[model samples]
Target chain A: MSETAQRGGAIPPNSATPLVSLRDIRLTFGSHQALRGVDLDVMPGECLALLGDNAAGKSTLSKVISGTYIPDSGTITVQGEEVRFTGPNDARSRNIEMVFQDLALCDHIDVVGNLFLGRELNKGPFLDQKAMLARAQEMLEALEIRIPRLTARVEKLSGGQRQAIAIARAASFQPKVLIMDEPTSALAVAEVEAVLSLINRVKAKGVGVVLITHRLQDVFRVCDRAAIMYEGTKVAERMIADTNLEEIVNLITGGH
Target chain B: MANYTERAKQSHAVEWLNDNAQVLSIALFFIACMGFFWALTDTFMTTGNLLNVVRQGAPVLIVAVAMTFVIMTAGIDLAVGSIVALINALAAILMANGFDWVTTSVMMLAAGAVVGLAQGWFISFQGIAAFIVTLAGMSILRGIALYITEGYSIPIKDQAGFFWLGRGTLAGIPVPAILAVLVAIIGFIIMRNTRYGRQVVAVGSNLEAARRVGMPARWIVCSVYMMSGIACAIAGLLIAARLGSGSSNAAVGFEMQVIAAVVLGGTSLMGGRGSILGTALGALTILIIGNGLILMHVSPFLTQIVTGVIILLAVWMNTRLFGAGFKLGKKG
Candidate 1:
């Protein structure tokens, strides 16, 4: 194993600055307080597992970081620079990418089209389909994902393949911070292994990864630190070496 | 360890057929309609009569092309027929007041864009349903047309050049027919090859997904309405040029015909799946039925009933037979 892997997916010891830091993030929708004054930090090359039960604000917190939601009150600092995001585009410009739990793919479009999505290659006014198809193959190949057809509509692909495409799209963009919400929730055992390894591959590049998952085994396998949320607030934070599945479950279930 | 079995690979021909099933079905229907008409009426197969059908079908074909874009986004512009009538009246009025045909035509197209943009703004930015907004537009526009002309058919004398656009033939082809063909070719190219076309499909397939990816989703939605408006303007001008007059009554129930053509061509009203070629075939099919029925001495009143039934049947076949999961043979 490499030195970083030996350290349980932590950033190299010499690096002190975090890739992203969220302080006192709060959000409300109508009468419901989805998140309340949550503070978190993700260091470069570290995989942070965010754990929570239902309605524990896991998805909300990640959305705030990804700019899907602007926190009602919070300060987000990226690489020691404070920033405010008006929308997902603002966050994307800063190399922040999110793999949405719903996959957020256009079903009518083919695989190559979805892989490029908003950033399509065009020869003047026309789409450069040939170039895009070639690049899509390379993108999937680099991830070791084998999709039988690139021109097939995304709706026709299996669940694992769809999830793989979503991850491939975000990872290919060289994001500084990657947020994945329940990426393995719907995958089979083999697909989960593929995704876990893919996450490791992305982490090896020094990108800060925040994985929101209910799967405790995934946290133990890949995370350096685990933060547990209960009822819209962070209950506890533990380094992977200092935590166990039973202790994390206690934290999530509101037990001491 | 879990084993993953690859999905069986389909042959190239089968895959192509599956992908193009909707368009292919519509193509076959169009040919069947032509064959049926040719057998029933000797004149229907003649060159001159066929040219006449193309000329008459030109306006519907032009608008149907634009409607393909609108329907692709899961939107409908019910006001299109009314907009055509309004522009038809406005063009004649402008020309009567000493405005040249060229300037009048340009101004009419601009007016169409303005009208479309207004409705698009309401639907896209203000969060109104496209059906409701365009429905209201339909009533308001036609009411304006009726109020302006006061039920009069205003004649446009002189301007042989303007009349040429409606009546003139190029190499024995009617000008309007030629214009409609050009629009279809352009629409096909745009839908198949352009970035804007991809954006349209993406937005239609999943609006939230398109927005999350930073596409100008609202703007794309609005632009399609503008395209519909431009097409209506062209259709209106063609009518006025051909008739040498304009009336508030022009293109009555025209939206039904255009929408019917689009849906019949296999463009899904649900949006995201459509073909301009399918729309062209659908329009031609409708025109052939109308012209052939008349030649067969069928009552003009019964023609409406037949057209409605055919539309229902075509759309039924489109959804039930040619829809997703439809296979050509036992292998599928």
Candidate 2:
């Protein structure tokens, strides 16, 4: 009876289908295939964790979704319309921003400058410093980032502060779906907590998040659903309540 | 608690000292040189000698300004000396061929810009190292200069304004000095105020990060080399006017002097950090040394060794002062 009800529960509230739906995605780099027939559905406002071991297709999927790579043969539909990304800039223009593993920040630039880098606030030809700073301050306050100086160079910032700024930059763009690849992997324990809070804040703002991480604790704590990829294929998709850490690890490491 | 506060105070003082070390070291060097000159010669401090220093240092200073940008990107342009010779020959050749002075001057400047762009494109876009490309450029440009004039010095006639640039003084300031100062001011403004300037610094610091952020790194690199070429051409024309003769041998070994001035000014050859004011001061320092040596009747042969030693010391001081501020490959 529970199984029947589980299958009949309005298909987990994807009433308008997924904001991003990837079907049978494949990626090959030279002799190695990074991703193979990977299918994913990310509904709006939900945090989905893509968990996998080293060399898994988690990074490739994130890259493809972020428009860094073109899948060899696949159908990616955004809001029920088939979409193909030519590059990262194209993906960003489509309101799909990815927080790369390296964060891709210009350290010499200040927090406000980094936040509004390529897409700066401008009044005609001049950069609108007042408006851009105000917007950056708002994003920081909303995320609860306790930076001592917003004008300080990113190079002088603490690790946590840098991470917060990176997230804020992506968040300020207000993408429909934010893809964060190992956002907290290099962060300390306190930094991790701050990042978790920031992610929740983004999710609350109605932006779907695809968190690609190796840590199981983050997956269970922050994510609604878990998708485990092994080798090049995603082998399992489970609700947070229905799975345990050990089982997920087994699925990632083993074929069955 | 008192110990912690005292330690903190000591560290803060040290940091302050480190930050101001560049200016402080230069001041000390300046004072010491002045004292030595006063002891050795009476004419060294005169206005006439000062004017002489300015006249002699102007061309080198102009070339050094452009060199600062190239060195700031951790790149080198070995073809600069040869390019200067080529420009000198071209200016004279155009004048001899019945071209008007204005058109000939414009043509020479354009030639420099084109040559710079060509070399820059090869280095920045073709994925070739700067040293290799500029090395080849140096030989190629020297060959072109030789081929054009057949190793002969040609006197530039019918171009009085061009001649005046090297020999004329304007309101107590020499023309070349004025030109150098103006170029330095423009360089300072661009590096400090403009977005494109910041991108150049960023690319020098890290190309991968710059590219990821959509900076036109190749363009910036290319533009810098082009500017360097234009500078060399200007300096070449100055040398030609000063001698009233354009030759393939004019401005020979000038690249070394330009690099020396930049390094003395605290502009590291490793790139990502430079200051135009520092470069100007560095050029002045070179002029002072050259003048002081001449007043003391030091042989030109020994002066080269002394200059080399002084440059090394200046770079050592720069490293000691700015070592903590710049991080090398800390990202990876």
Candidate 3:
């Protein structure tokens, strides 16, 4: 595993100081060691594709980065400063946002409300609907996401639209490190193209993006580096240009 | 030239209809009930009869308004009747001991809030289900009232202003009805325009999502219960003032009545959707049914059966007919 070039990060190795660095992180649930001694780095303006089979700790490791799960033993440093995140809110304050695979959204809440879920715009004691509506328009337009009506409840939208809303919400947070778990898995062909382009747009803005997906072809399209995991440990990290699809597939199945 | 690349816009009228399906259906049901009663009884449509309906329905209406918020968070307060009973008994007890009406009323409201907060703390912070906590509250609070009152009704001799709250009229409208309308209006504005209202709906719709977004999700859940408690206190005071007596058995079956009204008004029992206007109308419909049944010379006990059946039918129609997917507004 150490023989591979840039065996640095299923997180990636870059010249600049990483926006986020995770070292020897471990997490166990009951008897299952979800993540065992994982090291990763998220660099600025780069896209890192986290690759592994079903139980290779991709989600668990991503959760650690997002602060949904606190590791048992490890050090997580942001921009060279070590920190302990208490919860998701802690990670959010440091400009790290995650788009969940299942898309944690309130179906009954409108698109605008979902976009501003926890951070509502209030005028005195009331919801500032007029202000929020205007801001929501700007955010949606900036992302090039087209919803017929901003006031429409999320439940009424199609799957691709809902996914678009989730991505837009996270992207609008001005996050330095954006973690997206299966951003294009449920999307239609056109929607998938939209998401890939959006990833490039976010990367162009100098934001570090970590994408976790089962679609192998996606990494070749938007990822700068690919990190492979085998049984809770990172086995290989490669520049997208340095590795072919066969080698990544072999690495994923552990040379099966 | 149509730009087929861009999504077509929906007319605002359709959107408004989609958002208001529940309220509109409830309004239709309410009007049907009103018309049914008016046809059967000559006195049903009269101004005096209408005033009596609102006046009598005021207590249930006030509690139902708060119950809409509670239900919106997918919570139920089974103890509202017991809280009302306790407050009614306590108000009389306080007044009998030489406390003025204003002081006793203030003390009763505070007690109600304390009781509600305790229950909310258990339900929200301690992770207990709202139904279980409030169910226990129903029994314990009523038991306290019965124990203190010795199963007797306490009488109030004086306090004109307090009695006026229940019986006085301004512009020929019953004071209790006016108070109920004020409560309903305040509830409407809160649910429509306030941040607290939005928080309540979001928490009810999806607690985990609300929490993930960093909203005070648990606190919002707890606060709704407090509002329910305060509403119960207000209802209890009104009852005590109107009857000129406070009894241990006051507001018995009151929780069921309020729940029925909220449900009949298209406030989903499953949570995250509610309407104060629907609730007010729901309360009125039930009150009118009771009054109309008596006027038609039907057996008094049959009114309960009829009201229960009406609630069942109304809620069934609301869900099965105008269900969540039954949007009137069409998007292009």
Candidate 4:
């Protein structure tokens, strides 16, 4: 791990603390334990790839971080300060934004509407459409995203366009920590490239990123550190340069 | 490098047509209905007959405007007709007991909102399906009206101010029609331009998505029902003022007519898509068909059959013919 740590470019410097640290997080549902005693740390300007096979508790752990699940026992420290989140909103108030696997977009609304969603710009009692449109344009432009029609409803957009909008919405919120679950699962090759570049851009801003995906290639392309989970517990944490794809695959398939 | 095809850019006129296909189809259908009626009967084209149609259609138009919001949220309020009857009966009873029209009207409107809020609570907070909750409301509300009035039509007498609301003309236009128009205009602006309107559409489009985004999804869902209730109250008041009587039987089958108008106006029953302009045109269409059939000496009972068939036909055309890829053959 120490040998490959040097190759993990953009890793947070020693002076910077971990953006989020989790200790002994445990969660259960009826007879099943979704997460059991998981510990993890994410540093600023680093991309952490969460890897596991089906039913490996990867989603459960992400939900715990995103405040969709209340762990039975855990201490979550953000910027070295311990805190508890009651719901997703609480997590959001702390500038932790999650791009859900399903994208969580309103299809009937236009692109600007989806981007703004709950936080609409208002003038008096009405929505400031012009201001919102201008800001939405700026947001996409800043991210190097091209959406021809900002007023077009999201339902009409292609899969890649939809994913881009979802990421842009999360990225534009000034999030200190960004979590994405399988964001490029349904994208074409070029679209996947777009998203990978987007992740790099976000990471460049010193934001901690947690990417949960099944695509190992994506992990190699962007993630600096990889965590592998087995059953309901994390089994291995490896610096991306320290571990080969075979080693990570073995960790996921229980061969290690 | 992946060869990505540039997205096809549609001309502004084509984009506008695509966005408003449902509304345009309904508009064309409305115009066709008007032209057919005018060709059939000279009386149908007369200003007096048109004004009468507006007056008679005013109550349905008011309720239908509110129903557009309810339907846009992918929810239905079947109890609106029952609520109207209840308010109609309650208003007469209040006035008969020496309560002035102003006090009685205010009380009825409040009653309507309370009833709507109660039903909304069950549907939103309690996780009950809107259809089932409002179905129960339909029966219970109408039953309450019948029980209170005992199947009698209570007379409302000698309130000139109140009578003006239903019977008086403003610049030769019926007051009820004017009120309905104002309500429609307000509904149109709110749905098209306001933050609350956008929230309502967001909630309807995807409830879970709206909630995850921090919208007060439950509150938005509940408030639309309250709006429907208020509209029903206004409608009931208009009916009472027009007939000078209130009865449990008032506006029977009104929910069906209102829903038909909304659906015919291109509002989707599945939620997330609706148009207030389409709803107004739809209400006018129904009223015109009924009036024209009568003018052409069609049987009164046959009018119901025709209206029902037209609603079905109009919705069928909306979903099948004019839904998508519909073009006028000539490009702008």
lDDT of 2 at B203: 72
Report how far off residue A220 is in candidate 4 (Å): 0.6
For model 3, residues B173-281, the per-residue Cα lDDT tens digits are 9999999999999999899788788888889888888888788998999999999999999999999999988999999999999999898888877788778888988
The CAPRI quality class of candidate 3 comes to acceptable
Which digits, one per residue and each the tens of the lDDT, describe model 4 over residues A73-148?
9899999999899999989988899999999998889999999999999999989999999999999988888888
List clashing residue pairs in candidate 4: none
Q: Give the Å shift of residue B67 in candidate 1.
A: 0.7
Error of 3 at A233 (Å): 1.6
User: Whole-model Cα lDDT per candidate?
Assistant: 0.91, 0.80, 0.89, 0.91
Structural similarity to truth (TM-score) of each candidate: 0.95, 0.88, 0.95, 0.96
For each candidate, report its DockQ versus the true two-chain complex: 0.55, 0.25, 0.46, 0.55
Minimum summed lDDT over a 10-residue window in model 2 chain A is located at: A2-11
For each of the candidates, give the backbone clash count.
0, 0, 1, 0
Q: Model 1 Cα displacement at B167 (Å)?
A: 0.5
Question: What is candidate 1's CA lDDT for residue B313?
Answer: 94
TM-score (chain A only) for the predictions, listed in order? 0.92, 0.92, 0.95, 0.94
lDDT over C-alpha atoms for residue A48 of model 2: 92
Superposed by TM-score, candidate 1 places the C-alpha of residue B244 at a distance from the truth, in angstroms, of 0.6
Name the lDDT of candidate 3.
0.89
DockQ of 1: 0.55
